[model samples]
Target: MNIRKMADSGNDFLAETDSPLGLGESGKPIPSSPRVLSILSSVFERSIQKNEKLLKKLKTKDNVTVFHGSRAPTMGIGQYIDRISKYTCCGTPCLVVAYIYIERYLQKMDAYLTSLNVHRLLITSIMVAAKFNDAGCHNNTFFARVGGVSTKEMNRMEIEFLSNLDFRLHVTADIFRAHCLQLQKEGFGENPINHRPSNKTRAKCLPQIAGYTCRAV
Candidate 1:
């Protein structure tokens, strides 16, 4: 399907959650409503959990074989990262930074402007990340294909998602990248890829490194 058709489908699907039109009619913050907030929270939590699981699976010792078994021949995370890296001239580190940024942002928001569409949110986040880190990141069709949405739909979803976010696009995790680089220079090495760190260790170490970097910056 084309972008316009996909966008239309998204609009219809989102309408079931709540209309943005209701914002003006009710004169209340759209996301403040309990129902919408609940839905957004649920969606965000589930998406984060799934992302974490996927990351863990990918970082496992047997990841190469397992990833091949779990994904289509052409669409495994490794293949995806490899393709992106060739264009970006950066390794999976850039993608990890972007994912971390998206997750942190979602966690901070008390609610979404509309019911959060987790799938679209994830794809959009990845697109934004690619644009930030890759010099050659321009493929709406690829994003749509990977996201199982249409380019038009993805664009519309991005706009709506940003609107709900009040147009504030903060790439908070960029600082973390600098810190991670420094740590690696100081001998942290490429262990994050080769060795599976516990989620808690990953989470804790990232923030601490980011904090140090921020002070240095």
Candidate 2:
């Protein structure tokens, strides 16, 4: 979709809730909007629940996965993602692109987005998104600190994430639009991937996570 390029041409591609926060001095969107953060965190919460249900049915845990984490970290999804934005000041569009990267990895790899793996995957995806969508970006060492992982582990995770998705990180316009629509719908709980709170429903849904009161500027 060339998200960075789209910023200058106009936001014909973005939904009402997500476009404004992505704007930067160079025409790129700033770090992120609270609404987008709330929405994506909700989606991740659903993913965790769905995977847990599947695990229950299989009668086994599902921690046998890739990425660099040895155990699930103490931070919850909302806090962790909020931390990433605060530290890196990543553009809001990069967050969407990062979600795209996560979707690509899940669609291609035999992996699930559980707590143990989701954080690492998220950091890796966002890192990739920043590198791809922005003219300049933070190095892996900085991202490792943002993600609460060791630098070496961060490097390993970046390699594995690219490898698992076969380096297919580019998001086309159609795909990007479709994802935004689905995420918006999912956020509003009109037809969510999982059933739960829909405080993000500007139509009435993702209860904005606490402490995320400011946009990443």
Q: In terms of TM-score, which candidate is strongest?
A: 2
Tell me, by lDDT, which candidate is best.
Answer: 2
Model 2 misses residue 60 by how many Å?
3.4
lDDT of 1 by residue, 55-96 (tens): 567773221210012222223333333333333232233343
lDDT of each: 0.37, 0.68
| Shift of residue 74 alpha carbon in model 2, Å | 1.1
**What are the clash counts of all predictions, listed in order?**
1, 11
- Cα RMSD to the true fold for all candidates: 20.1, 7.9
Candidate 1 whole-model C-alpha lDDT, 0 to 1: 0.37
When summed lDDT is taken over every stretch of 10 residues in candidate 1, the lowest stretch is 208-217
TM values, all candidates: 0.37, 0.78
